[model samples]
Target: MSTSLVVGGSGRTGRRVVERLLAAGRPVAVLSRRPRPAAGVRTIVGDLDDPATWPAALADVDGVVVCVGPPHDAAGAETVVHRGVAALAAAAAERDLRVVLVSQIYVTRPQAHPAMAHVTEARARGEQALRASGADPAVVRPGWLTDEPATGVRLEQGDTGWPTALAALTPDAVAGSL
Candidate 1:
């Protein structure tokens, strides 16, 4: 059976992915700080800053989906996305697992805001780390994401707003990709 470890699996997209995986009869393990009810799914509780607590979840999995994000506080962005993801990539390498990242399209944008500069750069660095970790890495850089209902599904490759791009993927869509 194909097993998947979904980081931040309780968040907007993560939750959906977990549901889809379970529905598909895949062994799904979720890494999240919040304790949610995912009856048949395994929930590993831990923060990105301390992933060591749940090493078992990272072991022997076919694929890992990283949807972790940093806090809005200053300095948390790099610590969470860049540093944390780097560590996760190293661990995944040790386990010989493939990794998939859910990233923002801001890394490819023309302008960078002063407030979000580190966030943008860190996300790029995280991508680089994943690629160099000797694991098959797939990156999904979405535009803006909305929690609202999806009017329809369209997959286009362009400078779609990050939130909009994020909106393009429903939990079901991402789970199918996994």
Candidate 2:
């Protein structure tokens, strides 16, 4: 059986990814700062900012699903998002593992909500870092997430105007895509 690692798997979206992977009969592992015990999932406790804690978690995994978010402090975006993602990407590249990065939409926009500009900038930088890692990673940019059920999902390449109706995307839908 193929094994997959879900970074930030304790978070909402990452949890859903783990669930989907488990349902599909794939052995799954999660990387998080704290342990989350799921019946069929393995948990690895580590800090994303520190690459030294990654080897055991990345070992034997065929692919990775990264759904991490930056720290609340805007100034820490570089360390938490950019460098963290780079570290994961570098490890995956060395092991010849496929990667799927779950990023937010509008990260490439010139402007963003004042409170979110730093995160957007950080995500953009993360995307660049992944591309440069020589891993051929796949990046998914989802719209604002909601607890509501999935409906009328659509996929587009590159940036586009945000949808006026049903702008929210469900975690389940995103997980299915992953």
Query: What does each candidate score in C-alpha RMSD?
Result: 5.8, 4.8
Task: Candidate 2: list runs displaced more than 4 Å.
Answer: 163-178
Residues 150-173 of candidate 1 have per-residue lDDT tens digits of 655556575465566567588787
**Against the hidden reference, what TM-scores do the models get?**
0.79, 0.88
Residue 153 of candidate 1: its Cα lDDT?
Answer: 52
Candidate 2, residue 136: Cα displacement in angstroms equals 2.7
Backbone clash count, each prediction separately: 9, 0
Clashes of 2: 0
Error of 1 at 70 (Å): 1.6
TM-score of 1: 0.79
User: Candidate 2 at 66: error in angstroms?
Assistant: 0.5
Report residue 112 deviation for candidate 1 (angstroms). 3.7
lDDT of 2 by residue, 3-24 (tens): 8999999998888899899999
Q: Best lDDT goes to which candidate?
A: 2
